[model samples]
Target: MAADAAPRSLSGKVLDVLDAFSADAPELTLSDISRRTGLSLSTTHRIVRELSEWGALERQGRGPYRIGLRLFEVASLAPRGPQLREVALPYLEDLYEATHENVQLAVREGLELVFLERITGRDAVRVLTRVGGRFSLHATGVGLALLAFAPPEVQEQVLSGSLERWTERTITDQGQLRRMLADVRRTGVAISDRQVTMDALSVAAPVVGPDDCVVAALSLVVHADGASPHTLAPAVRTAARGISRALGSPTARRHPAGARRRASGP
Candidate 1:
């Protein structure tokens, strides 16, 4: 069967085929690919052949196909992904060693938080989050921090949308969420208590850019029991500042009091 009058060009069709593969469905058989892409079997096969030949997709042991290693190599060139991860890894490792928890780095892509990196300690709380995965802008601590610093229009959009509830503690009320965002702006951090998951809590801080604008957020998720968001705030803020400094932001200086004391002492 042919597709509807959607005016699908050759390039569009090829992109459609490629878009069929997602994190959930990383590998797909030919029929699965055709069904997911909404293309005919022959069209899917032809485009898949071309993509596979060009090293954009790869076939596995006589069955499914997945995104090729070449795509990953090319994606590594993306400044916001691998480049940011490379710069932030050492600090993230330090944070993990200090807390023995799940450390995450994320950036806003539209209204969603796209996790760029996640470092998990052996005994840390088990989280469903994955690197390169996306989550709601209102659920996670990093998401809240990013959303708090987002443009007014973006804030309005999120507020107007359906605030999906993930747990009993999830803040779905627009007014409450707004106030929480205000607090994040004032405190330079965000704390999510059992919001995304019942057993987890997260603390997050904003990462500023050269323009002193919040470009991303860094966070630590740990078990809720006996954990205090206030205690974790300083560590999250420190890591965020480190990443901001690496990003060439002048506002990335040490804590204000420490800087003042150092200047006064010398």
Candidate 2:
């Protein structure tokens, strides 16, 4: 406790410094942190020292710093994060084993998706998703699955916001994205074809919670070359249903196969 410091809200500056480390840049130098967070060098140094001592950040080899294990320990206590990972890992593994491709699990966080788990096989196509990473709701398969099942008001919010483009095929037009979402809801599947990147395609399905609400989404990503989202949809949907059932979603009971069953017969 500060014996003489003025009582005030916790420092936003500290969070900014921490937020500077992300999936794209997990390690940062003092100047990098200061620049990314818009904090002064002295201020960044001071907060970095405090956070390092507290185990919320750690020093890299010489100068750069990365997020510390202590933060992950704290994050694991969150039900929406690690708890969901614990419940979904087995099914995600099954999906991975069957396809030998990239399998992902994610949840909606406002207008973006926060990946909870990811499993990739050797030789699997590279994808932009990373565990604990965030991506726009308009481009990825899992994002579309979550967005399609979201309430109409939430959908409108996304449509009204600027749609950032990542690839030429990305749906920047509101009408096109709206139609894509409709297709996802109608078929209980989302197909992202060269949307996030030109070389990857993803098929995703929604996972329901005990309340019968879309709480998460599951996906399979593969090389865009000669791949068919329709061919992968069943497997993706099956894994999603299995995870939803594990989460106590009553609707998932209607799933036609065992949770661990692999899709068979092309």
Best-fitting candidate, measured by TM-score? Answer: 1
- Per-residue CA lDDT of candidate 1, range 76-178, in tens? 9988888888888988998898899999999999989899999998999988788989899998999999999999999999999999999999999999999
Candidates in order have lDDT scores of 0.88, 0.87
Per-residue lDDT over 1-266 for candidate 2, one digit per residue giving the tens place of the 0 to 100 score: 12133442338678778889887798999999888876778978899999999999988568689899999899999988999889999999999989999999999998888999889888999887778888999999999999999989989999999999999999999999989999998999999999999999999999999999999999999999999888898888888888898999876765544442344323
TM-scores across all candidates? Answer: 0.93, 0.85
For model 1, the local distance difference test gives 0.88
Give the Å error, residue 31, model 2.
4.6
Which 10 consecutive positions of candidate 2 have the poorest summed lDDT?
A: 1-10
Off by over 4 Å in 1: 253-266
Give candidate 2 regions above 4 Å deviation. Answer: 1-8, 31-46, 60-62, 254-266
